[model samples]
Target: MQTILIIEDEKDLAELVAFNLEREGFRVMTAHDGLTGLDQASRIKPDLVILDLMLPGLLGTEVCKTMKRNEKTAAIPVLMLTAKGEEIDKVVGFEVGAEDYVVKPFSTRELILRVRALLRRAATPPSPGSVVKVGPLTLDVERHSVAIDGAEVSFTSTEFKLLHILVQRQGRLQSREVLLRDVWGYAFVEDSRTVDTHITRLRGKMGAAGELIRTVRGFGYKIEL
Candidate 1:
């Protein structure tokens, strides 16, 4: 069974989510504060984490950043929960390495669907020993690792998947909707800005090699040599 960690300060809500997830046949763990959540994440290394944007001991963003920095836990997918639905808030959450975001007042069914989608995406098998090289970028798809000009770089699971798709379809224009569906496993596209935020971060992480990913102007993105 896949383990899911819920790092939410609201005891009632956290328990509610845990209950539903358990009913869905997942092993659930809960933490009421960000620091405890981080500790538990490092210790348990859950398959997926449901993190709240606001927490008492530490902010959820900090918890995610720390996890992304740690090699052991960096690849775990994080689904952020927040009451704020502003675009900037979502951008911040994505920037901090969250693989998905859910605004509060959301239905239990919606959350569950998202949870399942993230898990499915994370569980997708990569082609064995498949490596793609474009300019100064090299991606080992099977190992889920990236190297730029012989120097290794760390990428969150979501970022790596997004990059993998772009490189796989290199020279082909991918619309925001297509990217959201393919990379994120979202059946319906809510906001395409999520794709934008991740693309921006992907570029920054790639440094100059980021130029290999080109913007199609008012459309989406593509990879080119």
Candidate 2:
């Protein structure tokens, strides 16, 4: 069973989410604050995280940043929660490493659908069958291993799919939603932050090889080749 870690400061909301997720046959874990949430995430290494932006002790953005930086937890998908819908805040969430974003007062049905999409995307298998290399980066699709200059680079499953998509697309600009759908396979996931988080983690793992991924302003991301 897939497990989800829900990190929210509101006790009532947290319990409600946990209950719903359990009903859906998912193993659920929850935290009420950012610091505790972060610690639990590292320990459990959940399949996905439902994070609240206004968390106590540490901001959700800070927690996301730390998780994305750590090799062990970086690739875990995060769906950030927030009451504010400011464009800037959403952008910041994306920049800090959130896979998706959810506004407050959201519908429980929508929330459940989004969660299922992310989990499905995370579990989807790659189509690439052989090792594909572009410059110094080598992606062994079948084995799910990545290498830079022949040295192995550790990657989470989501990160691998994200990289494979970029490598296949090469110079074509891919919007965040497009990546989420093609790489993550979630058509209704409105939050592009999911793409940002996975991309950041992918780049960090690739080191110099990551430079192959380029940002397209007012559009999306691509591999320059």
Candidate 3:
């Protein structure tokens, strides 16, 4: 039973989400304000957090930043909820460490699917002895660990999957549509630019090792030493 924390200011909305998730066999917890939600997240350390962008005491971005900065709760995946559909808003959410974003006025079905996808991504480990090395970076697939120049680097589940796919097929061009389908489990190629946003964040996290990931003009990205 995976525990999920819902941080939404609207009581009715939170309850509705909690009810649906519970029906799907998830243990749900709710917090109506940002501060309370953040505190609850730190205390409970749920497997996943469904956080609204706007909150009473703190913004969802801030909560995400704090959670990502904290060692204990940083690995927990966050699915951001936002009323805004602007590409910039979604990018910001991802930049702040959100694993995925959900626009408001969303169907319950879509939201639930995204939640399940994120959990699946988080729980699945790499295959045995499938370690990958590019330049000074080393990815121990079996351990789900990435080290750059002998220093371990932290990546969100989404980022890790994206990197793993790229490195596994180093020098092979991967179209944005393919990456979305394979890494994000998107059935259709919607929001293809999201692949770009995540790539940018992944590169930033990788520091100098980021250069190993190359962009193919008008196509997608790849990794090559």
Candidate 4:
């Protein structure tokens, strides 16, 4: 059974979510504080994490960032769970390496669906063409590594997938909706800013090679050699 770790302070809510997830055939673990959650995540290395933004010991963003920095846990998917619905909050979550965001008062069904989608995406294998190169950027699909100008650069799984798609399609424009559905596995496009925030972060990490990913103004993004 796939393991899912839920880092939430609300005891009742945590139990409720755990129960539902267990019913859906997943092994669930819960932590009430950010520090404990981070520790458990490192030790057990759950397949996915459902993290709350507000916690007693540490902020969720810090936890996510630390996980992304650790080679052992960097590839695990994180789904941010919080009451905040502001655009800035979503951007912050994505910037910290969260693969998906779910606002409070969310439907149990929808949250479960999101969890399944994340798991599916994580389990997906690299395409038949394992290595893709464009200009100064080189991506090893099997190794899940990227290098620019012969120097390695770290990228979260989400960012890697997005960059891989853009590079594979080279000069084609990818609309935000298409990217959301393809990279994120979102059946419906809720917000386009998710795509924009990831693009900004992706560029920053790529340094000079970042320029290869060009914005198409009110449309989407495309990578050009």
Q: Write the per-residue lDDT of candidate 1 for residues 1-225, one digit (tens) a residue.
A: 999999999999999999999999999999999999999999999999999999999999999999988989987999999898888898788888899999998899989988988999888887567878998999998778999998999887788889999998999999999998898877556668888888988999999999999998889999998
Which TM-score value belongs to model 2?
A: 0.67
> Model 4 over residues 147-201: C-alpha lDDT tens digits?
9989999887888899999988999999999998889887556667788888988
As for model 1, its CA RMSD to the true structure in angstroms is 2.2
Which residue pairs clash in candidate 1?
A: none
- Tens-place lDDT digits, model 3, residues 1-225: 999999999999999999999999999999988899999999999999999999999999999999999998998999998798798898789878898888888899989988988888778766667777888999988787899999999887678888989988888999999998788776546768789889988889899889989999999999988
Clash counts per candidate, in order, are: 0, 4, 0, 0
**Which of the predicted structures, 1 or 3, would earn the higher lDDT when compared with the native?**
1
The 10-residue segment of model 1 with minimum total lDDT is 184-193
The candidate 2 region of ten consecutive residues with least summed lDDT is: 184-193
Clashing pairs in 3: none
TM-scores of the models, in the order given: 0.87, 0.67, 0.86, 0.88
Model 4 C-alpha RMSD to native: 2.1
- lDDT value, residue 210 of candidate 2: 81
**Candidate 2 deviant stretches above 4 angstroms:** 129-180, 189-225
Q: Highest TM-score: which candidate?
A: 4
Candidates, ranked, TM-score: 4, 1, 3, 2
